[model samples]
Target: MCEIFSKILQVPINHIKPIDYVPAAAAVNRPYDCHLSNNQLINLGININCIGFEDWWKNYLNN
Candidate 1:
């Protein structure tokens, strides 16, 4: 999912950052109850565009 999202967004895999909730999820101290898996978090970030959004939207809408 992360790979597909990255390709769709034209962003490199390494450039994608984890969502802010990741640390909070990890700090829960419950191994069995996972808030979000790594791949899921990465996919979320890719979907949300943690760093780039305004520029992409501008260019996308203008074009």
Candidate 2:
């Protein structure tokens, strides 16, 4: 899911933030928890980008 979303949102898989709660991200305007994963939530800032959705997307897409 994240892989496919990465293509659509134009962001890397590492930048996506996931959680038990979805719909908080999932935006082309920004980079956030764009998809819901069944995996355990282990947030160490490894695969999460806290730069919000829109800003992160802009910066990410620019590169």
lDDT agreement with native, every candidate: 0.62, 0.62
Clashing pairs in 2: 30-53, 30-54, 31-53
TM-scores of the candidates are: 0.23, 0.24
lDDT (C-alpha) at residue 58 in model 1? 49
lDDT of 2 at 13: 82
lDDT of 2 by residue, 30-56 (tens): 667688763454454345436755666
Worst 10 residues of 1 by lDDT: 47-56
lDDT of 2: 0.62
Off by over 4 Å in 2: 1-49
Candidate 2, residue 42: Cα displacement in angstroms equals 9.5
RMSD of 1: 13.6
